[model samples]
Target: MSALQVGLAVAGGLLLGGVIAWETWNARRRAPRQPVPERRPPAPEEGERVEPGVASALPTADDERLEPGFDTAPGALSPLGPVPAPEKRPRLDALIDVIAPIALDGRVVSGDAALAALPATRRVGSKPFAVEGRNVLTEEWEFPIAGQRYDALQAGVQLANRTGPLNEIEYSEYVMKAQHFADALGGAPEFPDMLHEVARARELDEFAATHDAQLSFTLRARLTAWSPGFVHQQAARLGFTAGAIPGRMVLPAEEPGLPPVLGLVFDPRAALSEDPEQSAINSLALSLDVPQVHRNARPFGRLRDVAFALAEVMDGEITDDTGQPLRTEMIDKIGQDLAQLYDTLDAHDLAAGSPQARRLFS
Candidate 1:
């Protein structure tokens, strides 16, 4: 071996070693983190058969925080999880605080009297109104006005319209109603120009549009495979009640007054089919009407679990709204987007799923 040959061999060995080290570092950096495994209930013993329609036992309070994983076998519907408490309502911004106030005169007029003077109907066009005391912003009502006797008192009425500005007809109707109420009370009425509030309403509406998002996942069974009855049975076991429309199942909102957050439709139009057998369900859909539902609420996690479980049981694949296959990575990405959206709404004092927001968004 010559000196030059020995030197060249050493240099090549060092270069190869450095290249291998760089590749290893890059691979580790690019690798995804493993998700925490969801806790699941133990399987039934051999020869044991669970009947459909029997409700699963509820989890204890301490176990409420844990989420369940999706299972594929028959009778594996996961129990519903607890809903997290909503974030505190934030103070309303000046823009959102804008109101079209109607003030009436007469100490004789009580809240009931003023309310009676207005149209008997609760809503003017699509905008709902509330009668309040001199202060229209507060929830307090002027009914049973008690105080020192005065020549006249002011009764205020305002609209509950949100997420959109009032149109010309709505504005006209509101002003007319206020004037009519004043006349009935035998006192004059005053109102702010509709255009000013309309402008402000538009700004709030724009903010809502920017933050609003709808999340949906579709499940398609292997072609010509599952029956509609099977889909319905599985969905019922998962806690979805049948909706008004056939083939539609809804998970009722956790908070009674709120709207349902998630819906499952199995071939929505199957009932209209001439041949019942031909209408066998080929695909199922799961969707969340995001703005209508609160984030981190039980429905959010439960819906995801139900979709995954159904996909497993039916030998189906889950896809995005556009029909592209949905992967676990995609689910995480969607979740991150939702968290950011919730933060934005909270910052603006319009937390999604709050009472005020529900009225506005509705």
Candidate 2:
């Protein structure tokens, strides 16, 4: 080839390569930044012992199960990080529920039979209606599981909850469901007197009303509004994860099955937007359902700290539900009040974060 032609060819190739590189850089610059996953510490060079870390993104379709780090019990720690154990829900208690015994004709029922006979909804007029069987082998009360034989079964409905005390209608519905449940299993249910249970429910409800305390603070953008990505990214840095619902992020409790320690919620529409980056979010709420979290988790402290931190990072101002900007003194006062409330709950034996408290508040 001629020298002139060769030179021209070389220049053409260089120009094409430069254009491709420029396009690649520009595309990346325009693309929304993704969350940077919090990497877990490396395992002891032995092998793949999945040491789960803070979840940064939703699990892919192929994920085998709720990624590990949740099987551990509350407050329990491991070498890697906090492995919040899944909570084994509390069983039936006569103090909190109206109990009824099901006579199984002295005949042990198979687990499948018991499960099949239980009520389908597991709820009776805003109260939790549940059935538990006495394990034939261990004599322990539990929800019937496969491969077990049950010698006895009991049904109960919660006496009171945040919604208020169980009334006559709810008690009657409980009775009907429990009776039907027993009949389906060829057994008979002996329920407590509706009047007595209703009275007990009212008393319990009064006590719960005095103790229940849920705190929330709104974080409003001070100057520049934030994108959904900015909010989520900041929360993730503070050990938050994407919750099941949109616009909701949570700092998971040390106990897995229990409700989250603290929750942050903004605009659900923004979360549902086709391009979250383009959505501007001006305000979000940080909340703590006091009774739902254990005292040891220091949920109140975390709520306060997170609110302050987010406000600082996101250039926001913290305010009450009434929209009045909260000063530091106001926050401290609320903490003091929370402490007193905790004392009250503890005195009633429904200490915050206990299963009973969680159930009652819920």
Compare the candidates by lDDT and give the number of the best one. 2
Candidate 1 has what TM-score?
Answer: 0.65
lDDT of 1: 0.59
Supply candidate 1's per-residue lDDT for 327.
87
**TM of each candidate vs. truth:** 0.65, 0.76
- Candidate 2 lDDT score relative to the true structure: 0.81
Clashes of 2: 2
Q: After superposing candidate 1, which stretches have Cα over 4 Å from the reference? A: 1-115, 124-126, 133-139, 142-164, 272-278
- After superposition, candidate 2 runs with Cα above 4 Å error: 1-87
Give a tens-digit lDDT track for model 1, residues 13-66: 999999999999876543322222345668879999966674453332234222
The digit string of per-residue lDDT tens for model 2 on 47-91 reads: 657666664443332333322223212233334344334448588
How well does candidate 2 match the true structure in TM-score terms? 0.76
